[model samples]
Target: MSCLKLNNLACGYPQHGTKNSELLVVNQLNLTLNDGEIACLLGPSGCGKTTVLRAIAGFHGLNAGEIWLSDHKLADVNSAVPPERRRIGMVFQDYALFPHLSVKDNVTFGLHKLSKSEQNSICHEMLSLVKLEHLGDRFPHELSGGQQQRVALARALAAKPSLLLLDEPFSNLDVDLRRTLALEVRNILKQQNITAIMVTHDQEEAFAFADVIGVMNDGKLHQWDTPYNLYHQPNSRFVASFIGQGVFLSGRINKQHIETELGHVACDVSSSVSENIVSENTETHVDVLVRPDDIIHDQNSTVTGEVCGKIFAGTSTLYTLKLPSGTELLANFPSHLDYSLGQEIPLSANFQHLISYAKETA
Candidate 1:
């Protein structure tokens, strides 16, 4: 059984006084978190990802369905079982560390409920877990962004909580620091074997830190899968465009081969199912997702496109190409192979992995 399960949950505030006045923040949300797995709620701003987290934390009540935490039905409607009673640790975007308190004291604050010896032992273990043992005396303002974030993590872990909730924990850090802290935090959580639910709008962070990523849009989860599967085998067009860098183009399937305007790709969307194209349907309009790496600049290729723009990003160059049919596509080429702007270059779609979306379904 899963450690946490949300069954058809609907959460929102009632606007004004009408039966249909409830603004659905999370609509029939269903999710299951296995023990020791890190799941992420990812989407753009105002997608109700944070609301779902709050609901899970028992800060908000659900209007329909149910929530279970290890076989306990949490259905308190009036007075929430206070944040303290939930045994859930939280890390926010601002770090939320007490400015006046030292890192060690902050970590020990939650441990005060235990015996003196137990508090000391737990504080020591959490500090060690976040690699901030030596800087325990430092105040929040005195530490760097990464160090402060680690201290916040240490404080959360010190409680020995059943579950952890992180709300954009690295949003305030720089890009380089964000990347490093995400990896470090993921390592710490995995080492302790903690089950956590994190909310972030960053695709990179979700891909790096989460074992299962739930992509939310318009207050609903569209897809929940591993990072590799979400990228390579997207279930919907919204998922295909939202999960990775890609430009979707119109295409048609012909005898197990998909023919797009760029090129022909042969990949089975239904690998296990033995369902071919229905009778009298030779071509179906499918939105083909092509990544920047999929389009290759080959001089011997017959297809050519005009380079609309180019950006040198150190390791690779991002090129915006305009095809003859007026379709726009982005291509990533090695930085060593220099190309001029507005130059007509031969490009071909070399992607073996194809993700297709039916027009009606997408």
Candidate 2:
């Protein structure tokens, strides 16, 4: 049985002094989560990632469709479960720790229904799970940002909720700490076999922490897929642009090849590019997505491009190369071979497969 399922889930916020006026924030959202799987809703601000989280957590009643936990219906148009009754745990971005409570007390807050001894037992187990057993007695203010986050996670888990919802949980931490703590938290959730859904705009964090990721764009889900697929086989141009470092170059598709200024890519580009690739004159124009790694600095190749710009990125250098036709492309070459600006260097594309999009209508 699926641990969580959203079927055509839609929601909107009501405008003041109006019965039918609502600004829709989520539209026809559908996704499924299996037991113990970690999923993430990833997108930019105002894209409804957090809105979906809140709706799933029972903070908002869906204007359409249903939410099911396994075989049980948790929410719908005519029926809705209260937040506390939904058995969903949430860890907020701010940690939301009670200043007056110690770490131990905060962890046990949700266990109030249980007996004192049982609460203490659960609290200790949660603290151990978060690897903060020694700091259980300290107040939230005394703990570091990461430690406080751990405490918040422990408290959420102590309720033994059916699923956990994390809303930008690591955004408060520094870059290095965010990476480290995201990995650690993922391990903890996996070890406990906790089914979880997180909301984050950081692509790197989503790749590191989630088993599957749903890419969102303005109030809609573009794709719900593995990180590898989102990066390599994006369903839409929006996803390709949002997920990675890429620059789109214009190309013409003829039979089995896409002819770009860089070179000819011998592959069936239709399936990866867009729907209905055929049109008049036996040719279709497409915008090809080329990553930095796709184009390489090749000393032996005859094709040469002028070095227009460069960024020294530690292990690898990012170069902006301009073709003879004045089209610019990005390439990642080894840092050791740094070419001066305005120098012409031989470059080659090792394209395994081509990805392109249909030309947008004017």
Clashes of each: 0, 0
**lDDT string, candidate 1, 198-221, tens digits:** 999999988889999999998899
In candidate 1, residue 318 scores what lDDT? Answer: 94
**Best of the candidates, lDDT:** 2
lDDT of 2 by residue, 33-67 (tens): 99999999999899998889999899888889899
Query: How good is model 2 by TM-score?
Result: 0.95
Each model's Cα RMSD: 2.7, 1.7
Lowest-lDDT window of 10 residues in candidate 1?
271-280
lDDT of model 2 at position 17: 92
